[model samples]
Target chain A: MYSYSEFDEAFVRERVSQFRAQVERRIDGSLTEDEFKPLRLMNGLYLQLHAYMLRVAIPYGTLAPHQMRQLAMIAERWDKGYGHFTTRQNIQFNWPKLKDVPDILDALADVEMHAIQTSGNTIRNVTADHFAGAAADEIADPRPVAELLRQWSTDHPEFQFLPRKFKIAITGSPNDRAVTKAHDIGLRMVRNEAGEEGFEVIVGGGLGRTPMIGKVIREFLPREDLLPYVEAIVSVWNLLGRRDNKFKARIKITVHEHGIEEIRRLVEDRFTEIRPGFSGVDQEVLAGLEAAFARPSLPERSLGGFESAYTNDPVFRAWSDTNVAEHAVPGYGIVTISLKAHGKTPGDASADQMRLMADLAEELGHSEIRISHEQNVILPHVHKSDLPRVHAALKEAGLGTANVGLASDIIACPGMDYCALATARSIPIAQEIAERVDELKIEHEVGHLKIKISGCINACGHHHVGHIGILGLDRAGVENYQITLGGDGTESASIGERAGPGFSADQIVPAIERLILAYLDLRESDSETFIQSYRRLGPAPFKAALYPETAEKERADAA
Target chain B: MSRKFTPKVVTGNALIEGDAVWLTEDDRWTREMSEAELIEDEAHAQMRLLFGQSQPSVVVGVYLADAKAGLNGPEPTHFREDFRTRGPSNYPHGKQATA
Candidate 1:
């Protein structure tokens, strides 16, 4: 992890002080509600349905043990002893009072973290692959570039108030774990013909009401040109994006109205205008940034215990199979502690769990933790020898659920439960579905399925990219859930297609069950995942399963 | 012929606690929706909303939401408003925890 420079420390401290004063002014009536809202939002504070929610950015989803402890302390002291990790690799404290929020911000600054640009139309927290530095298949650690982008975009006056909130994700690995194709701007690190690593820049991708896979505007951009080039893209959008209707304001909409070719031309023109101003200073910063992220070579450790545990314990074997991934370093593994334990709220970690993770990270793993966009915590560089012990600790803390990419690993937004913008409840639906799936005992058999549920069309849960997506809607004051199938959020990104009429909340879980059960029969083999089978067989079979009665009625009517 | 207007209540989140609160007929905020003052008339509902909005220090995002006068008090007509009354459903947190 990069230590904060004196300049960075001073900058964050100043922001905390400024926000403290702003809160005081708002309380004293010097600032009206209208005036205060944006100020609070800019500081990552939102007046949610039930309370003031403060979103704290975990830059590129990386956290030091000390930072994790601070987060736990904040959760215990100011919040409800829990924090909800969101899809954007951010943690949201749901019950921070307005007066206490400043203190929270100051505490965050103590650990070189701040909520700046976590909200508002500014370039939000620049997320990267959670397995960035540790992934076995990574071409290069993308966090240095992500960090460079974060430093460049933080309080950037020129792009602060865009037409709508902008999100950018970068993935160094070819596997695309960061869901790059679903962000406003997606940067996939790639090598050119010359064999120098650069970026394949994709723009116009978003997952709100209008879900889109970003189009590749640039085939390969030199690593040095990233900042200025991205600046140009946003600048083009800043000028052309609609400000009239909030719904039509995102850069994705602008890119949709104008073809990607035209947008690329405009961005290129803008890039040329600003290219001279950079003059290679960014390269200097990136060099320093890269050095900060360089991991010391780890001595190979014995994996005797790891092998013994995997063979000896069925529980450990199941967990290792699902929760652990290959690490770049030999004898090391990347562990994803499932936050989606059956019947628990997805993405939520208790304060005690946070402290436990911190302790484990310090003792066993490197003093590092990561929040995955899938709403799970990742100890990105854990030694394989320590796997059983870590698993035991996690089991004790109610964090061990051997269902990482399986059916129970669902992504659900804080729908009507806590989100003021939500039209219906999403959490309970997610909980019910997970419980149902666990009861059926087919989670492992389902194999590599991503079920995502969103409370509304806002698509906060990234429902558009799920293998099986569920969208909660308010139909004449009743909760209705619509299903979409074959949506994927990987290298082969595709938006799921809706399967006919929506089901009532009561009918949703059963509908999903029907779909999954149908996939089992439809798939060529057990190895063929739900997504592969869906692509091969199309949505017809799944749709038929979801609406069996309706299909039968239609067939009978036709007859 | 004019369509009959559904009942409504002036609702907003508390300024400090941020919990959902509804306006009473006597110009007070109550966390319980059951104690909320139900206004059948659109003009009265607008007036109540204005009154709720005026207290910027007390509440935020004041608006009129569809409701019906139950046997005890004002009941939410929409599922969203109902959720606002009873915190998140995933766990016993927020208002549900306290209530």
Candidate 2:
């Protein structure tokens, strides 16, 4: 994890003081609602359905044990005893009072965390692969680059007020765990023909009302030229991006209007103008960051406990099988703590739960806790021998869920339950789906499947990439759900195609049950996942499952 | 032909607490939806909305919500207003918790 420097510390403290003054002004009636709204939004405050939601940025999903403890403290003292971890790798406290926000920010700054630039038109939190440092297949940890971008874009003078909000995602590995293809600027670290490490720069990929796969502008960009080149891309988009219609203001629409080739040419031209100004200072900064992010040494440890526990304890074995991933080290494993326990709200952790996780991370997980975009917590480095103890602690807290990528481990936005912008209730739908899957006892048997739900068309839940995507909408005052099949978010990213007619809220869970049953019957083998089966058979059978009467009517007409 | 105006209530969130509040006939911002003055006429609803919006520092996002005359006083017609009257379905917090 990267610790804040003196400058960072002072800058954050200054922002808190400024916000404190602004809050006073608003309370005293000096600032109007319109005036305070943007100011509040810039500091990651938003008026939601029930209360104000404060989104605190967990920079690149990294947290120290003390920071985690402080977050728990804030939840206990200021919020509703719990906080929500979002798909953007940030934590949202849904019930902070306006009067307490400044104090909440002061508390956050005490732990070197702040909500600055988590919202508004400026660059949001720079996200990376949750398995960045620990994944066995990682070429290098993406944190250094992610942190560099964070430092550069925090309050970039030239790009503060862009045409619209911009998002950036980077990954060091070829596996693409960060969903790089769906970001405004996707940076994938790659080794060129000469074996020199560089990046494949992807531009204009986004998911919202309009979803588009990012196009590769530069197949290989030397690591040294990252700052100037990225500036050039954002600069060009800032100029060419639409401002009249907020709907068409993203870089994706800009890229759509002017073809990727033209955009690439413009970026190259802009790069020529701005390249000399960068002057290798970013590389020097990166070297310092790399030193700060150095992984702790893990000497060899015995796996006798791990082996015995796996063999003797069925519950431990089940959790290890589902929630654990291979770490870069030989005697270590990456543990994903599932926030989606059966029938509970996804991504919500109580203050006690947070404190327990903090202790667990410090004692057993190298004091490092990572929040993943999939709404789960990751202990990046845990010894295999300590697996049983970790599992025991998690189980005691009702946090030891054996589903990570299973069907029951769904990613859902706050939806109508908490979000003011949501069209329908996403949380209840997700809860019902998880309960149904649990009741059927088919999650482990069903194997790895992603079911992402979004309350609105904002795509905050990454519903477009779900293996079984459920988009909740308000069709003429009633809650309606539309299902999509075969969407993927990986090295091979593709948007999901919509199935036939939407289902009512009452009929949705059963409809999903029918789809899964049909998938089980249609799959060629157990090894074939849901996405594979859908691709092999196409949407015909799944459509039939979703709308049996329509499929029957069509069959009869064809016959 | 244009549809007739439905019964409505002036609603907003308290600026300090950020909880749901409804405008009453006596110019009070009450937390309970049942305490709100249900306006059947469009003109009266607009007047109530103006009254809600006037308290800029005390409230935020003042608007009219569809309602119906109930035995309690006023009932929310939309599920959203119903949610606001109580709280989120998942957690027993907000008005529901206290009530």
DockQ category of candidate 1: high
Give residue A170's lDDT in candidate 1 (0 to 100): 98
Q: Any runs in candidate 2 off by more than 4 Å, and if so which? A: none
Cα lDDT of model 1 by residue, A436-543, tens digit: 999999999889999999999999999999999999998887999989888999999999999889999889999899888999899899899999999998888888
> Clash pairs of candidate 2?
none
Candidate that would win on lDDT: 2
lDDT of 1 by residue, B1-99 (tens): 899998999999888889899998888999999998999998888888888999998888999899987899989877788888887777777777777
TM-scores of the models, in the order given: 0.98, 0.99
* Predicted candidate 2 versus true structure: per-residue lDDT over A351-409, tens digit per residue: 99999999999999989899999999999999999999999999999999999999989
Interface RMSD of 1: 0.9
